[model samples]
Target: MHTTTPTVIITGASSGIGLAIAETFLAQGYNVVGNARNAARLEQTLAALNCGERFLAVAGDIAEPNTARQLVTHAVQRFGRIDVLVNNAGVFIAKPFIEYDQGDIAQLIATNLMGTVNASQAVAAQMIKQGSGRIVNVTASIALQPLQRVPSAIPILIKGGLNQLTRALALELAPHNIQVNAVAPGLIDTPMHTPETHEFLCGLQPAGRIGRPQEIADAVLHLSQAGFTSGAILPVDGGMSSGVW
Candidate 1:
């Protein structure tokens, strides 16, 4: 570890892609602040990772603006400054557009779109004051390419919104030396999907298999270090965005 290690704040860090990203950064000797709604789950995550003093867990629902504020505040208080932020907290429910009720719409907006906006707003303010920062948002490939089999139009609305906001914020924050980007992943092999459905999901990606959480983690790490890259929506979806595999 360097004498002055940089710090990262990752949302939804208790499991799946978020958990992998947190582990990756911690392994690279960066101070990590992991946030999730379940405090006990966050504690278990911290214990499992065993990053010692370099990792801190902040538990909260990022859909709330106050949670975002508290995440930034706690990170700075513990690590002095936040160098990177990964807005990976989101929800997805696949169903026919007509089947999605108002509650589903509201939940998707809260967790996916507003969560990204709220967290980015808080982190950007701190980054602007520091004069440099990296923000990597976790979106879905469905944002760019719709899947006939998925029938997830309602959820796509929120993730697609994130893609647009990534470019907008990137341009707006470029002058301040902050890079804003997003990663659009395809069907990833997380706990969200059961093993019985893995083979079916695999066929959804052109790569002929589901992606690993570590793969998305690697993409986020790359964008963070890619100084000249901003506003770029890098799709790690194994050709899902490409027509006919």
Candidate 2:
């Protein structure tokens, strides 16, 4: 590892695409601070990764601004400074719009929308102080190109806003030498998708198969290092953002 390699804070890093991002960054020798709501799960994840001192698991709800602030403090205190933040914490509720109850709507907003906002807002301030950083959000490609078979209006409504926000944040932070980008992924093979739904989920996209979490992780890593690439929402979903299937 270099003497001053990047230190990254990856929210929702206990599983799925977030986990992959954590592992990818650690493997590349970046100091990683992984956050999740469940403390026990985060401990298990830290133990399982066996990444030694390079990885730090900080448990917290990304939806809460206090948690976001704590994550930044832990990362900075442990690694000296923060270089990248992956706002990968989110929740997806897939059902008919009318079927969504108050709880469902609230959960979706708190996790998917507010979670990103909280983390990004807190991290952006730190980055501004440091004079450089990268913010990569894990959005959804299906939000831009909704599947008729999957009617998740509220979730899409939240993610679509994130897509636009990525652009807006990129422009806002560009002068500070901070890049904000996003990777909009399609259906991926993760614990989030059970085995039974794999086949059906595959058919929703033109890829004819599910994407791997590593693909999304790779996209995030690219954006983290791509100095000139800001505000661009790269689609990692196999043609899902192209058009209607």
The lDDT leader among the candidates is: 1
Cα RMSD (angstroms) for every candidate in the order listed: 1.6, 1.5
* Worst ten in a row by lDDT for model 2: 1-10
lDDT of 1: 0.92
Q: Using Cα atoms with residue i matched to residue i, what is each candidate's TM-score against the true structure?
A: 0.97, 0.97
TM-score of model 2 relative to the true fold?
Answer: 0.97
Q: If candidate 2 were superposed on the true structure by all CA atoms, what would the RMSD be? A: 1.5
lDDT of each: 0.92, 0.91
State the TM-score for model 1.
Answer: 0.97
Clashing pairs in 2: none
